[model samples]
Every structure is written in structure tokens, then in C-alpha cells.
Target chain A: MSQKQIAGVTIDVNDEGYMTNHAQWNRDVAAALAKEEGIDLTEGHWKVLDFIDKDFKEKSAVPGMRRMNKVGGIETKELYSLFPNGPIKKATKIAGYPKPVSCV
Target chain B: MPDDDEIKKVSIIVSRGSLEGVYPGLIMANGARMKGIDANLFFTFFGLHAIVKKKMNNIKIGTVGNPALCVPTPMGVGMPTWLGAIPGMSWIATAMMKKEMEKIDIPPVGEFVEMIHDAGGKIYACKATVDMFKLAPQDFCPQVDKVLTVGEFYEMSAGAQIIFT
Candidate 1:
């Protein structure tokens, strides 16, 4: 498979700027995750999703929870609250990013 | 090009009881599975409680000197880990952690374990630690795959990156 295919999600950019094939699905998943954790998705949520996607793309590994916490400047407690199901999995899924290989 | 056979393995060793300590293992293990890598979690010592008897998601916070618990000041004030052992502190700390987790979208321990299982990651209980702590299999979360000795765990973690969180 080519790099694009291996990456799983398709990226498309138009007049509206970059949009991913799984954008709608990601939003839906993020909304569900947010509901489960009883938090609203603010700008902070997008920031984290962006970070996870970028990091995973570059490193080919999911950012460890601590790295995410430190880079996001989010406390572990607060980060857990946002990702109650765990950030790397739930958040990546919601962000339409591939799941990291190290997760399970 | 990255060779198909060159896939890296990641193994995590969990040994603490605080939400901070426990969640990292769970999240990393699950993330590894998601990425199609070989991943495993070996729960030992106090970390065993995270996967034990439905108590994984119920981990209390270490309110003592946990840097994460501090409020923002001109500098900043954080909870010290030392306070985690104070009498009656675990209860309050756990409550705070639960509340914090609820505020975010993370699931409780039970559900998180379910998620890990669903993602195809392996979970093991440390046999020696279990015996040392007098814990039975029934004391562990139902999702555990087996009770393994440290030797067995090391064997599984061998040839992989071992992370102690």
C-alpha cells in the first residue's frame, strides 16, 4: 500500500481549507466522547486532537500519556477527565487518526 | 522504506496505584494495539490493583505531593506525593480523581479495561506479586488474560521497548 493508504484516512483540501475523509466521523466520535466525560469540546479539544495526529504521523507511535499531558499543559487528572476512556485511544479514534500500535 | 517485518514492540510495566500512574499503562497499551504493534501490560505490585477486582478505574489520587494537584499561582502549587499515605487521605484523593475523570471523557477502570480488551491488547497479572500480596485471580479485573511470573513477563517484554510507568 502507498503511504496515503497506509495512513488510513484520506486528506482533502479545498476552499474551506484541509478536511479529512473521516472528519464527520471524528466529530461524531469526539462529541460522544465528550458527552461520556461530561465536558464540552472547547478549543482545547481540537488542540489536543491536532497534536495527537501530528505526533503519530511523525513518530509512527502514539505519544505516551505523559508526553501528551506535558505538551498539552494539561494535568493528568484533567487530561483523564477529557479522555476518560484514555486519550490515545478514544481521542485518536475521535480525531479520525489511526490507533497507536502500543496501546493495548 | 520501513520494512513490514521491522515493526517495533512496546511493553509497559505498571506498578503504582494512583490514577496518574495507572492510566498511562492503560492508554499506552491500548494505543499500541491501535497502531498494529505488539503491546502488553504487566501489572505488578500496587499497580496490580488497577486491574484487580473491578478496582482499576477506581484508583485514588496521591494528594500528598503530587505536582499535578497544585493550583496555579504566580509560580504554582501542586499536591505532594508524600501525602498519599496519610490516613483517610486516599478516600478524599480518590473522590477528587473520580470527579476529575468524570469531568473529562475518560471511562472508569472497568470500561477502560473493556476498551483495552476490545482493542486486542494483552493484560497480565504478576503471579509473584499476587502471591506476595495474597490476591486471588478473582481479585483481578475479569479482563486479565493470565497470572504470569516476573520471568514470564520479562520473556514477553523481551525484544521490545519496556516502559516502567
Candidate 2:
């Protein structure tokens, strides 16, 4: 366990930097996390994040990338461009959701 | 810092045709593409069966002599190898696996390949295997981009992370 402070707020995070407490999330935290990943939060990024958050609450796991593109209403290429290191990993982590158990 | 944002690519080699052996490459390649990374898959040896039009979707699960078979269930208990070796068990096991994948919204083989292709992942056949098997272009599913020699595969995969499954 570790603590990370961003935008003057403290949150608990796992060693991998994923927030351990989902309830601590706010838009400011998302923006700060995205900035750390070298991303500038945009409407497109928010769209995917919003989908991830909503899906996590409803389905208990963020939809895989194909579903995110097809059902979550974002194009595959656009998702990559938004969270370039690894789209699903980066976006869900920033969205304040637990990392997917099956994703590598 | 600039290097952190550089787009990455991966090249995967699929060398077996068993349902267990084949799907990892498909899933990983698809995952990479969904993340916006370029992915190339090279199917060789028995792995060609994964792309073979008539056989791709019909590949069976390996039950006999397989030590790693785990029947995922609520109890978390695994199927013993002896049980797996029983007559007709492979078919039953395959059906169970397919049903489980469907529960998680994972697509079948043919549809999985199409989704990967639609996401811009490139699938290829190994030239040697295609020649050894005397397979023609039409023998493969439409999603396979081309058949390539080992040298060509290495050339295309230059600087990309390469994985064998």
C-alpha cells in the first residue's frame, strides 16, 4: 500500500499506482492522473473514462477494448491515441477503477 | 520523456492449434490493437489450423495427455488428467470452454479474428508451414493478411516486442 497526493488531495494507491479506494476519486484526481501519464484530458478521453466508470459500477469490470470501441462508442484508434501506453490499462486506472483481473 | 509516448508494436507467433494453445495469441493481439498498438500474428506449424477456414472454429480442446487442463468453475476445482482422457471428454470440455468464454462476452474464433482484423491487427501465415501443408490462400480465412517467410517476419517485426504462444 502507498499514498499518492495529487491536486492537494491524498489517496491510497497500490504499488502500481492504481487507486485502492474507488470512493476517493473525483474529476480532479482523474485530471491529475492523466497528466502524470502525459495526457491532456479531453472530451474524447472523458468519454472513455466515463464509460469505464459506468461499466465498472454496473458490470464490475471495465469492458475489454473491442467492446469499448463498439459498445462504449469510441473508435479503437482513437482510444490508443488517447491513452497511448496501453489504452485499457491507462484509462481504467485513471478512471479510478480497479485494474482488470484478466487484462495483461 | 518523449520515448514514453512512442507507440509500441508487438509480433506474436502462434505455433499450436489446440484451443488452449491458439486463443492466447488471438486474445493478446486483439488486446494490443484495442489499446491502439500495432500487432502482427504469425501462425506456424500446427498453428496454421487456427487460420484454416474449415478448421479454425472447429479446433478441439486437448484432453488426453494434457496436464494443465483446468475446468474453471465456482468450486475452483480442476479436472484431473484421467477424467480428461475419458472417451468423448474433449468434446464436452470444448463445449464448456466455449460456453464460459461466451459468458464473459468473448467471441468465437472466426469472429475473434475478424474483430482483430477490423481493429487493424495484421494476421499472417508462416510460409514454410503453408508450403509443408500445401495450403493455398483460399484455404485460410479472409482475415489473414499474407504468408511470410521467417526472414520477412523478423524484418517486419523489427524493434517490436515479439512473443511466442
Candidate 1 per-residue lDDT, tens place, A67-101, comes to 56555554444444456544556666556555444
Q: Please state the error at residue A63 of candidate 2 in Å.
A: 2.9
**Cα distance off (Å), candidate 2, residue A93:** 1.7
The DockQ figures for the candidates are 0.12, 0.23
Q: Please, what are the lDDT tens digits per residue for candidate 2 over residues B1-165?
A: 496676589999999999988999999998787566889999999999988999999988889887767767524666677997788888988998899787676778887887777667898999999999999989999989999999999999998999999
Comparing only chain B with the true structure, the TM-scores of all models are 0.80, 0.91
lDDT at B32 for candidate 1? 65
lDDT of 1: 0.66
Off by over 4 Å in 1: A1-104, B4-7, B72-76, B79-89
> What shift in Å separates residue B159 of candidate 2 from its native position after superposition?
4.8
State the fraction of real interface contacts model 1 keeps: 0.18
Best by DockQ: 2
Query: What is the docking quality class of candidate 1?
Result: incorrect
For model 1, how does the per-residue alpha-carbon lDDT over B1-165 read when each residue is reduced to its tens digit? 466565468878999987777888887776666555677888889998888775665677666765565533214566465755579876775676666665454557776776666556678888888899888767877779999987888888878889999
Candidate 2 collision pairs: none
